[model samples]
Target: MNSRTPRPPHGSSRAGPPPRPGRRTFGAVCAAVGALVLAAPGCGVLSPGSNGQTSDDITVTSTMIREGEAIPARFTCKGEGVSPPLRWSGLPDETESLAIIVDDPESVGGAAVHWVLYGLDPENPELPEGTVPQNGKQGQNSKEQAAYDPPCPSGDTAHEFRFTVYALKADIALPDGAPLDQALGAVASNTLARGRLIATGGR
Candidate 1:
């Protein structure tokens, strides 16, 4: 029962573009003067689509986690037993539903399922920390239980957990507690876009 606090979406922290040479400098100076007259606050210059609000702007991140790294037992099959927090931004305005799935890529056969959640509100970009929806549809994990079953690799080597987020156009039609394949089928049928984050944990 691994538990983890949800992390907030990280806003980009970057400096503005470098000042141009004389010709561009003169144009910039004029723009700055106009901003002063309008009493507009300074604005950050960013590359297009840097903010995760548009269809092409979303970004996903985990708390102190990276792709392919070993995940801590606290968030694995052997600890405090809470779902890890996940955060994302930049969904297309038309997104209606969201789904999340976490799995172990190094499981016994091909890959193993750990957690599956679907029908989340796209408007709510952050899932509450340590949440494992007891009543939500629990899919059949690798162990065949309708609950989160973290990776417990047999050997001493660490295992990687891949967390994925899907932006869908509609709620999946599957029933609660559906099997993993059924749930995934619904996602593939309706997904408009998706993103991923990875972390590792082992005994």
Candidate 2:
């Protein structure tokens, strides 16, 4: 006098529920970030790069490349060999000038300075792509030339390049085409704040 339900299924082929729409895969997240980077491609302080310690207010960025990303060949010897668009922000009010250094620490001899620029207008925080320094003067690089020596890594893998900006109390007084060491020393002495962006390049 009791009623019971019977089951007909064994090892059913029915599918589980679809993945949650709210969840994001690693590749999806990276693609989204890369798209954001591509959308912004000129010299303006859009966002911060890989300089992790946020305690420092100053930041440097390049619209051409993101942190740990490949620098465009147009900015390297393989292409047009011009400087990429760069910008910065978070300078203190006392800042009278700014400086920039692009170098490769993984050089054959030692740290190879690629490009050096100082005496930038602190109030202005943009260096347009392929543009030469206006108020600031360019300095010598590892190649012993006072110009942007684009990255030319010989190996299969790309080399890390650093683009550092220094907020200075006053303009660096070194003569144009001054030695890299002297220019670097001047920046270090007068720097009030600093930030950097690391990029990659290869032949």
Candidate 3:
């Protein structure tokens, strides 16, 4: 599990110009961002605030589990399989929308997505336990269903499950029950900043 990032060192300067827009599709853009290639110089980091300062990172926290720790059965397939309560803070002031994804990257075939959620308003950054945002759209995960899929790793090997939140410069347009890759692409193209929370789960 990673610790909170310390604030960017002091010494304010003029905020840079808005990042140059890219002409690529959302999927390619997302792959670049995910790889930290950033497409091009001006297309990477988002614009800072009027004060030439970036807002705090959008962090995700949960009362359900701690970083790198085992998740209780009540939140997994062996139990109720409910989505955990999540709260976010330090959102960039200019954030227009947000996206959330929960997945396991160590699955046998590849990254196994457990949840694909999007369209959360920046105004409110909390998702209550066992619920989804009213206006948000749910995407289909590896299970081919548009809902929360509990972490159910095979055997006794503990698995790491990540809950990531992406702050976007604008609201993303997505159809209901979109596929995982499509959801990620929309998120990557407009991502301003991203935060994450991780936990472990095992049968």
Index of the highest-lDDT prediction: 3
What tens digits encode model 3's per-residue C-alpha lDDT throughout 92-144?
A: 76678788878775545444667778887666657777776666778766666
Ranking by lDDT: 3, 2, 1
Candidate 1 off by > 4 Å: 1-57, 64-68, 132-136
- Itemize residue pairs with steric clashes in candidate 2: none
Candidate 2 residues 78-190, lDDT tens each?
89877888889888777787888777655444446677778777656777776655466777665656677777765665577878777777778887788655676566567
The alpha-carbon RMSD values of the candidates against the true structure, listed in the order shown, are: 20.0, 24.4, 13.1
Error of 2 at 146 (Å): 1.1
TM-score of each: 0.64, 0.69, 0.71
